[model samples]
Target chain A: MKRRLLLVSNSTLHGGGYLDHCQQHISSFFGKNVKRVLFVPYALHDRDGYTKTARDKFKSLGYDVDGIHEVADPVEAVRKAEGIFIGGGNTFRLLKSLYDNNVVTEIRKRVMEDGVPYMGSSAGTNVATISISTTNDMPIVFPPTFSAIGLIPFNINPHYLDSDPNSRHMGETREQRITQYHEEPNTPCVLGLREGSMLLVEGKKATLLGTTKARLFTSGKPSVEYDPGSDLSFLLTDPMRS
Target chain B: MKRRLLLVSNSTLHGGGYLDHCQQHISSFFGKNVKRVLFVPYALHDRDGYTKTARDKFKSLGYDVDGIHEVADPVEAVRKAEGIFIGGGNTFRLLKSLYDNNVVTEIRKRVMEDGVPYMGSSAGTNVATISISTTNDMPIVFPPTFSAIGLIPFNINPHYLDSDPNSRHMGETREQRITQYHEEPNTPCVLGLREGSMLLVEGKKATLLGTTKARLFTSGKPSVEYDPGSDLSFLLTDPMRS
Candidate 1:
């Protein structure tokens, strides 16, 4: 089976309704076959509220959204899910819950082996990568490890912001942070997905989607930019796996 | 022996030279008796370059500085040092080196038990606290643990920035990130130190230093603001310790 994934940088854009900016992409990705999406609201503290917002938005798009939290057995739910969607919030909390629920393996299998459609926004998108090391969220809690779902071979830095020459903040810029990640030996490439941008992957092909361009950082190489509709299938090639 | 510490929010403020804004506090914190300081430049990748910057600045303040990396044994370097200073870079990288060099326990003892004056800027200030959960830096690398030296009872969010109301970025503001941190049970209070602000600790008493106000966030309570010279001794009282 081939993998199908839509990884979004954010759930809501400034002045936009939840998932409003990416409605068209979300619709096209799921197509008419996926009737429902199993929502993982663990990233957020208010699971019920998160689910309601996701449920309402997906409903308008003609799909029922079932929160994995609402189910009795989460692992079984992942195994039986028609489609899987993880919402945005704190990345640390999201990864912790993913481990605590013991569905990491099941979800990986569902998406990798069974070809269930997977959708993730922000923290959700972060977990779909090899590791959450590139996430911008605070490490409020400790998970057993930083290793994530690995649905994709590389890491995704959602809401990637470029340095403002006018700003005087002393903290590391998004690019600098990703550069630091590349310092680690054998680390994978990192994609900096700006707001309103996302990656659409099907089988062995991956493409940049949405309005903005994405920055790609690979070890020992100059960072490059990819515009909308550019082929990003090279990102799916995991040297370790290949 | 009294515990002495100077935790700074940043090494260089906007339009200011390195440590130029906080020279008086650093001078007073070290006093005339401490003529030399041991520097930890592990947070940054370029140890020599970071050390040179720190060395020049401390020299201008009338102190001889030696990089810990220059010494044969980092543990011994921490033991006989008149004052210990850890410069700012990446928090994860800093904490990892602290553990990797086998000096966390030694440095903690040098400050907590031996009363050797200790100073930290940015990333350095973060590790002096209970954990690095509230840091503003990216987790570029995985440390063995989120735990730090814990010279103080709570966590410090250095280079903390207030939300710009005019900005349209959908990412969570600094305050929201700390709020998410309090959602975890038994988490310690977090202090958000704005740029140019710092904390001065002597024995059981802690005082907010520098020009800016600091925000303190305790779990299940509203955050409170503290001006310069405000008594923050209560923060030193750890519920777990006492």
Candidate 2:
């Protein structure tokens, strides 16, 4: 139980401001003692700009946030951090940065072994899962691998949405795409984390934290929907209970 | 100008039948003389089932279509093919299969060198580009490479959509994603082909064939919208005229 993770579906809600709904959760999860937060800003095209935006937002929440890029050593930055926050823009870019910086192992060690509180949204949430396989982002760049930090057992389809049943477009719906993914036997379960939804994980317990219901897709099994505030900790277990 | 290719944005229109709008174009492009079409059904989970569906549809158009999977040697089939059709499902799967079967070279030879009439929709259209980097599909599985047949001079965003101007979704918009891609500077132009649109390429000349206005994104240049029936062959040229 040496892990603390607050994985949010998105940074902003529809018609809301930046990091609107996630601020309170982040503050509560980190508590007042955590001061210096190491921010992963690689998902965006402009690292400094993205970090500035995140920094300003976190500043308003009474926390000192530093971009991992601002530091000379990414691994050392994570080791010295009181908390970690990964801002989402592009999952491929973020995952590649983790590998390219050679800090994937360091961050894993810091979070899993050191129990540094971790928070992520959108692409951040995608990387906190078992793999980056379920992300909805374009494959703009090839990553070294699809592997990600296994902060949680299941994969996350952040900013998840249902297909517009009435649209004439032929693109596969989010549901269809994930369904095809489960076509391969033994694939892990996927959580369709809709906008405004999130998963709060502390040690062995995890909870769905939002108004929207999360859709769980399991191979060879009917997809189930869990309401907000529902116990989703079992999802953190291997071969999740039905 | 030995290559002839028909790239469609999608297989079916919303609330419409499968491949309905595309049958005429397919028939006209292939004509009655071209029999024995080699179909690539590797994108779908059920290759045989997808082949059967396509066969029925193409048969009604007076064409003899055979799935590449049915042949003993896929390369041999492509070599003898009068034309080629790649059905849509998943781009990652299709590209992986193309590499796994060692048919990527064969198909490129047949299409780029031998001048075989080629048709692809959705995931199929995705591989017709320089790379699969612009595809909107999930990264369900890793392909050996993001490299595709390079049938076209530039990349494609198949099933392209304009971001909803009225709403708030934290996920990057189709435009934002492609624009971010262009930020890399050396990235090639991206043609966003909306549903119901098709691009017709014969040798070095290419034409947009549907009603949708294809948005072309080039770095350091404003995106231009090309109306249906416009000559896009200029897009085939290197260092496109501003």
Candidate 3:
């Protein structure tokens, strides 16, 4: 069997303080001869903190951190690595860099075709969707299009959470965002991921890892929230064969 | 042969404002004997000022207004209606009502199957997408779950505007919101609809209606801007056949 992919929430050493517990869920994966970590530059301006923390974590478990490059070299890095970890950042910036450099195509090949372990946190995980139309960011600086590697069919809105009870932003809440997504392409599911949550995909299996609940939205239906750590692998694996 | 659908902007009379220009477009359709209008309560509140304006406008135009409660009922109202006009109000609220009443499924049947002329303004227009995830409203309350009728295959963030350059929101501008959406799903095209803008979809034809420019984003690529009133029906139409 091929190794699984690992996407981290943040490239920061301490996991952006929000996803502090995410590391624990994947510790078992790391323990299983999973070596080599790649830090996406679109999210990391300085890999010093993230690289060091990741190195320490891996080293303590007898694993090695393979490559940390400032340039976009996803294909080469993932091709040789046993596992991959994509940390989070401004998803727009990260995706822009990936698209600009054509790294998305390459990464797709490595993870989906070669069966390399592909892991992503935050923005990294978000790129798996067909269109990131539900993200709560300005569309001016970034393009208003969404495309993905197709490892998964649905789009993801990572770092998703319910509205802050005290937020005065005067905008729709997280649930509202997903509903709007359904209004467009009602079939593609929108995964609203909360902090410390990780969606583990293996072949056709997807497991939600973390404390917060994951919300699922389908077209014309009300959104439903599932408990943390649910077996959502059905979403990843194609049901067509069944 | 089936009559074509006519999507009007806001039904609310603007009292001769610039937005009132849409009336010319609406009248053009009526000139062809396209009668019977289904007023979408999905976006309008009975108590709202805009709703009153829309009612008055329809009456003045000599067209009968059928609320969601009247006509053949929501289903019959959709099927028997010669035209469908989704007026503007709070799009989120309207979407909520649609989801609550299960009217989205019916509207979809009418427009996609029955070929009812579907017209909308502002919030009404926003719901024409696969999902209404792009409206510019804050999700004040979470609907049972957020999803809208997907008359079109993409997401639309209506009421798009450049920052006032003077007003201070002190955060991401409208452009940024769409950009972030691209980073996540990176597939469905996100359209920024400014005031007076409309997208006329006839069979396989999608004509852009308005004066300002709209922006587009694709995965891994830089964002691009489009001038309004362009015949970019290809964006919404099926190029393979049309």
Candidate 4:
């Protein structure tokens, strides 16, 4: 599949407006033929408000945007969409809404077979991987299964943060948590996609973008950090990636 | 049920040894009749090593500790145990192991109905509540269900931390994540048990212990912070607690 994806780590930077850092990247990814973007507001608590916000953002990019929920047939809207975008919120709730509407397979098929350019941030980026198992969000809702769109080989842990050794708190750090994951049988390779970073994929090539260094974790191997613009395409084709 | 419980928010302080801060408190909780503690080390990745460390600490406290895994029958061990201790690790893996071995109901029955003293730290503390949904750990493993021991009325968010408002990070803070939980339908009351804090439950009362303030969150109510030694027992009998 000639798939194109922009798996964003977060929607906004520390002090930037929503999608401000991503507007140019998104426009460049979609190109001229993309006159409309189908927005999945399922992750949001207030769907209407979220949709309206995303709609305005995309509209500023000179495209008409519609929330899949606003339409009677979400699957049909997905089928006819020029581009698709899934916003971030609670991953569990997002996956549950997808399963409840029976749209996971439809969205997966479209992004994989139809080769419709797809973009996701936070919870959205979580669903783009094998499963949303590494998400940092609370389990506010129960999804039918942990299965998700395997658009890429390895799992992406968006908005990843390292442990603060100086902090008085004793909670497990992100790295420690991921180490526990590797201890489990048959754990997948995980990319600790720090905030402000995004993974751009086209065809079989995936590149890590943004200024921050990202951490790559695999079992029985030492985790390594990669600088910005590193070629991460190896993850897309590694059968024993885990 | 005449249950005695000590739900510790963490196993260690910032620069302390494992369970070092709570060793005396644990000894007091178990009393002289509890000669041995059945330790559930399932939450830990290195169960054997973790049990060894915990055993050393408990041994110093003048008690024999048995790792449940070393025993032939985990359920039977819980049944015959004078006191049960669940050490902290990953909540998801711990609950999954409990459900897999059919030990949740047995342990719950023993601690809640038979009056066997029980204690849990970190992920362990998270499970001694209505559900493990409020845990701050990664979703490294999926439990068969979110159903937990239900020893307490509300859920416990162990090692809870507040938002660093001055930080440049864009990820949701602990408070925001819990608020997202409340937005979901039928959310239970969540107690943000800060590090160094714990809940001591006896008979019909539960009291907050240690130096830090614990955050209380309930739907349609402003989240409030409770100082140390606060009586939080009313939550035990509130039918509409959520």
Per lDDT, the best of the predicted structures is 1
DockQ of 2: 0.76
lDDT of 1 by residue, B159-237 (tens): 9898999988999999999999988888888889999899999999999999899988888888889999998988888
DockQ, candidate 4, vs. native dimer: 0.82
Candidate achieving the largest TM-score: 4
Q: DockQ of every model listed?
A: 0.75, 0.76, 0.05, 0.82
Give TM-scores for every candidate, taking all chains together and pairing residue i with residue i: 0.97, 0.97, 0.50, 0.98
Q: What's the i-RMS for candidate 3 in angstroms?
A: 10.4
lDDT of 1 by residue, A1-242 (tens): 47999999999999999999999999999999999899999999999999999999999999999999998999999998999999999999999999999999999999999999999999999999999999999999988888999999888999999998999888778888888888778888889999989999999999999999999888888888999999988778762322
Q: State the lDDT of candidate 2 residue by residue for A77-134, as single tens digits.
A: 8889999999898899899889999888887888888899999999998998889999
The residue-level lDDT of candidate 4 at A51 comes to 94
lDDT of each: 0.92, 0.87, 0.59, 0.88
Worst 10 residues of 1 chain B by lDDT: B233-242
Error of 1 at B229 (Å): 1.7
The residue-level lDDT of candidate 3 at B165 comes to: 69
Model 4 residue A90 CA deviation (Å) reads 0.7
| Candidate 2 chain B weakest lDDT stretch, 10 residues | B233-242
CAPRI quality band, candidate 1: medium
